[model samples]
Target: MAVYTHVSAEALEALLARYDVGELVSAKGIAEGVENSNYLVDTTRARFILTLYEKRVDAGDLPFFLALLDHLAERGNPVPRAIPDRAGVQVQTVEGRPACLIEFLPGVSLSHPTPRQAASAGRALGAMHAALRDFTPTRPNGLGVDAWRPLLNRCSGDLDQIAPDLFATISAALDDVERDWPRSLPTGTIHADLFPDNVLVRGDSVSGLIDFYFACTDIRAYDLAVTHSAWAFDATGAPVDAGVGANILGGYASAFGLSSEERAALPILARGACIRFLLTRAWDWLNTPADALVTRKDPVAYLRRLEWYRANPGCFA
Candidate 1:
């Protein structure tokens, strides 16, 4: 979120006028995410995250995302709530981009989590699943396995530059994931992309989970799969201490228990996690501007994880 769309101070003033959040004393670009443009917005009343929905975020999906945020926050979930404007609207147009002011959540996202930290994140993930149990509306996971193939195809022709046979490797892995992918499993609100960066921690406990842009109704264990690959692996994409993975499993079991079928599907879902990040990394690697402020992560790291999962499918067992 490193200043994708530059909003001047004058533009900020106009945007602030639409909301009752006092004055815009300072606004600085937040250097956290690769999607959406975010600013650390401060007003006379309080601080907030001023987000300008980027092209990657669909305007049609705005209502769902906003409503979900409101729902989670109201349930005492540790998520940022969208601040409604003077007109009682949470979303508006600023600099011709869909924008919203979100209450600033406290705590920092952990880059390298210990086993204890992973346990806290796992409990938080389970709690999130339970808290949203009654959220009536459902949003399908657009980035689920169905969406992986086209993105893989889009990146196929250019993947040779990344590594020999990389495209074929991913294409084959996609086939495996789809073949083994569960047709019927526990489905609910899942933070499909619960990577370490999206999970915030303060002290030994989880402060909250953020970045619900990828939130959708999917297999609950799939969320754990996503988090497993995210939290149980080092930056090198190799599994961390075995205890860390077990710790996550234990924490998740505390609230929403995983069915045996869900446990069995974890391997394939974890592999899907690798595929999801790999395609995006490959696509962004080829497309991101050279001078862009964002860091383009090497796609090979996930490729390593894919290979490891293929060799040792008992990662979550």
Candidate 2:
């Protein structure tokens, strides 16, 4: 959710004319995330989101993402559906990039979530996994364990610039994670990047689960691990709030029970989750342009999480 490409008023009006969303009253750029260009669009009919698929997002994968949202919305998951144009086209070309007008779900993204809010988010995630159980479309996890080492290799030159001994430490962690990566587990379509901002809450309940850009076919527990790593930690990567983590697990369990095998694999899966964010953040930190309209996240944050996971393997137990 960043603004790389700027659309002029005339261009925006032309684009809006393709759909029945009415004349554009206002559109503002969203600058929170680093993946795509997003704008909070308002029109005569209603509010909506205009997302321009950025370079990092492969245009070919737009159908999978849009269809996933449709499927989840059909099953009553709190997800936004892509709005189709007058010609019944969901995907459209806007400003020379593939784009979509997304349904604007009503909710606010929480920065510092309470335990009860975390529990609601967990339940939403569990229900999402359940809804996706019968979804047959399969897209492999592009950022899975196998892709970590290569991603790390790309960031090797600038690893130590971010932190001391970061390269060697990440290399060793990758070695261990690859060596013991889970062979078999219950797999399904997962919201691989279930960070705090991706979830929208109305009071204590989840109102929307936005951002399906990173959703893919992966291990079910790994999705939980990603959510745990995201919601259970502070900005400095400290596990200061035990209540949040506990309630998240409890709420998720109440909705979707994890097998004993999945439970046993949590620690390692969490380590893998940490590595995924650490590497991607490092890459973005090193490569993103200084003038880019996006926030550059700290790679050291996830480094701290990796250290905690290593020292406290039984943290999940």
Candidate 3:
């Protein structure tokens, strides 16, 4: 049967042979993401994550993204190491799509992360920031302001139709955020999309983080903002048991220690973070294919977050 993504099982197995890993025992589809087709492959030795890069991910950025992960793993981060083939190539073509195998990290995502767990995520994210501080990789922020402008323009014409006042409110919010978007604030590689599903939790602990397709060089506070948007809320858009913004910040602060300027930027950056996902989900909601097994994540969820941020702008402080 044809999987929902780039290629099929038979083609993936052929590529696996190029690596040192033994025969592939089994391959199964993963339905978590809407961006790419992902699979869990069980090899003779260990499990691996196979992704067929799709439209949302540019084929060119693979080297920098993969190399950055390798760099982080080398610094003792729990990031998955990308498997290279016998020819020492980090990526290859599989099923007519650029494919790569990553060591499967074992962990359950915590729907209800404890205060300690929130703190752990904070530190882990902070540690990721520290490890990538001096990374020489240069790539434009994929989810940056310029990228969002087009979507905003698309939504503006129908603002009154889709969600009425809320749409107008978000448009205005984006304008406000742009007026003071950080021009310079300790730039580094950031996990621009750190949603809970992208994070792996093992026994109430985050064992690994997956999905670096959205990773890019940007303001460090923006990364923290993405985590805040992900880890601070429940699936239904309600606030979960985790410590929310305050606790997450505490954990992050204890780890890499945010500067006063960084701390000051958190609220606005958090607003920007809320707006970023809001626009993307809105765009995806309109664009996702009907036959796809992956359910489109709600853009309204981020709208709720934006509402929350608007009401309590001082909460970040």
Candidate 4:
């Protein structure tokens, strides 16, 4: 998460007063993502994350995210557990915004994940879906097909300005997605943004799965599609290593069954995943000021992958 919301030491200390997480011995702002303001909070007992929810996060959706993390963490997903304050509330207001203290998971996100790492990620991802099968609360995927066009429209001014032919390519892809989007599939809770950085791998297996803010009710296979895009493709949409896709898909299939219909819809779903990231990243890239400390991911990276997906449908075997 980003650090758009500035928390002074006094403000942080005051916020920590509500929780028994020990004194905020120290805090460091995290700059990995663009949604919320996250800080690594250190105390006498353990390390934690102090996330100040930003405008992108809806106030009403906070409980769903926190409860889902707590549910999955208890079910062996290795996710960051939401630490409720002494008052027994998981989320509170800090710096005039909804904030949370999540138990920090250990391990670094892989920059160039190996086939084994990809496989483990897939397995862990599948386990998450399985664990959440009975979680009754639901939240719609705000960035899914219905939001794609509107997001595109918001970023229309910056598409061609960012790169030539970008708008036309994205428009065509969105059209294709809407025209043939799958009507029905296996529905379940999904970590909608399980990118490489969102997963933590210590060795051969995954130590943790972070960032459940985007988690929502969606097709289980669509989660695999997002993972495929995140793990198998490079920034230029070229294959980083052969058989990587098979490794991940194989690992996922080992834990979760994929039907023939799911297999047939993989291409379109992957394309939908591509468009989602492309539009969102482009929006962030264009809107975020250059001087901001947060990392601005290249939207074109997803564009490259989208083009590749369009040209090579059924690439996932």
Candidate 5:
């Protein structure tokens, strides 16, 4: 939510002019994101999310994320459709970073989701996975295994202060997967960060999904694993409520039944998924400047989560 790139009010006004929107009525910062400067823009035409890419987002890969949203919207996914400029291009440079205006989706994210909400989120995620089943466009995984391993090593010295057991367990888990992680497990386009905060809901249904910055090509089962790590776990990484896991998995299964093999891999993948987030948060915590306007999400939160996963390994079953 930091203003990494400076976009003036005049610049925003010009952007509104480019669209059919009559006038820029107002603009305000939307919190909860760390990688980009996002503003909720209100205009005569409609509300939209204007984003200026930051250090975390590679401008080169903007096309895939934007195009993927377009593809999903075209495929009937309840996602925000990117608004194109007068030149008919959905992506363009604004301020300093690659910028795009996305249609503002209605509804709020589940900061404290109930079991039913969790299930509904699962259903929506499954639908999104199915929607992008055959999407073959190429893009590198933003935080692929190789990119991730180095961070783990960098943070190894601090493991004792954080969560020592989880640190060792995660390192071992990653090693195990490196040896036998499947080369093929239904690969395709996936929303790697399908957290509750990224999902918008209206009433009992999921209305839209936002923040495609982490979207990329990866194993479909990995997507499910990421979703499980987000929706099914508590602050301590233990299953939140008795029915949370069942509801989520059940909803996803109804949408696209997981193979027995896929089911077997879920627990391991979930552990790896936890480690991925833990390392990323640690990297950000160590690297992020103290003066940045954005809030640094706690790396220790995921550390505790890893510990809980280690204690209650049966929860993944």
Candidate 6:
């Protein structure tokens, strides 16, 4: 989504030569996300996404991500698949980084989604979980609850710089979340980072779900919690739209209903979701280079969400 590495015309042409995608007309850098270097590549025949995996992404995990996309696409989930070259290779080396030419799915990412869009996104998430039920490849959630404290610890020294008492507040929230973290729940492959930008929508229906870099094996409800935390709130972390949250839950339930246990654990899981993003955003905010072609998201945005979830635990009820 961000362009850390620049692709030259010659290099891009050489890369395109390996595939039958025709002559490259244009390849513009996409600067929306912080994870990988992405370019909107256009050739004579079609359009595609050229993603250069960054250091944060493990090259070893490329197969799992690509295969998951293929699986989801086969099962009717709106996901982009990696395009293989003439040698049947999906992963290629670009400027010493792993890269892939991905199918370009049509639709625009919404910044402030409507309730109907939220509902459709929720339904797509449910349907994704259903499709992944039989997927046997398992990748652990690297950013799960267990990683929250350590991540926050890395950002502890600089916490007050972002906000007064931010460290203590996050520490206490982490303590509570860890103490009450769900022991058992339905687990599966989940799109752990289904933020508004990750979802592509045409009308009220989900056209595609992009960015599987964070997909992993985790508690199913936790995925819903992540989506809820993402779609239910505005950019400032205010839950000003109640219908958005309700419609998300309703649409998800219609597609893949949650168990009673999952329902009960939602509030806590939501808190954990908040903390997870809070710590990661804080870490990124503190660490990302100023000159990097990416935006440093506000860490306190998730802090507001955490406070809201704490005061309104029954929001999920």
Q: How much lDDT does each candidate structure score?
A: 0.84, 0.91, 0.79, 0.86, 0.77, 0.92
TM-score of 5: 0.92
lDDT of 6 by residue, 1-317 (tens): 79889889898999999999999999899888789999999999999999999977999999899999999999999999999999999999888889999999999999989999999998999999999989999999999998888888888769888899999999999999999999789899999999999999999999999999999999999999999999888888988579898888888999999888998999999999999998888888888877788877888999999999999999878
Tens digits of per-residue lDDT for model 3 on 70-175? 9989998888877888988878887778878888888877666777777778888988988887788878897787677777887664544546675777778888
Clash pairs (backbone) in predicted model 6:
none
RMSD of 2: 0.9
Better of 4 and 6 by lDDT: 6
TM-scores of all predicted structures = 0.96, 0.98, 0.93, 0.96, 0.92, 0.99
The true-versus-predicted C-alpha distance at residue 191 of model 6, in Å, is 0.5
Which residue pairs show collisions in model 4? none
Q: Write the per-residue lDDT of candidate 4 for residues 1-317, one digit (tens) a residue.
A: 78888889999888788888778789999998899899998987789999988878898998898888879877877988778888898888888999888889889998788899888988888788889989999999998889999999888857998889888889988898999999788898899898889999899789999988888998889999999988888766666785667777888888777788998899999989999998998899888977666988888888888878878886876
Residue-level lDDT of model 1, residues 178-213, one tens digit each, is: 898988987888888888888778887888778888
Candidate 6, TM-score vs. the true structure? 0.99
What is the per-residue lDDT of model 2 for residues 257-306, given as tens digits with 9 covering 90 to 100?
Answer: 87889989999999999999999999988988888889888889999998
Worst 10 residues of 1 by lDDT: 288-297
Q: After aligning candidate 2 to the native by TM-score, how far in Å is the CA of 168 from where it should be?
A: 0.6
lDDT of 5 by residue, 221-300 (tens): 88888887787766545457767677778888888778877777776666667778988877777677776667777666
Q: Better model by TM-score, 3 or 5?
A: 3
Evaluation by TM-score, superior candidate among 3 and 6: 6
Runs in model 3 lying further than 4 Å from the true structure = 1-3, 156-162
Task: Point out where model 1 deviates above 4 Å.
Answer: none
Error of 2 at 314 (Å): 1.7
Ranking the candidates on lDDT from highest down gives 6, 2, 4, 1, 3, 5
Highest lDDT against the true fold, candidate: 6
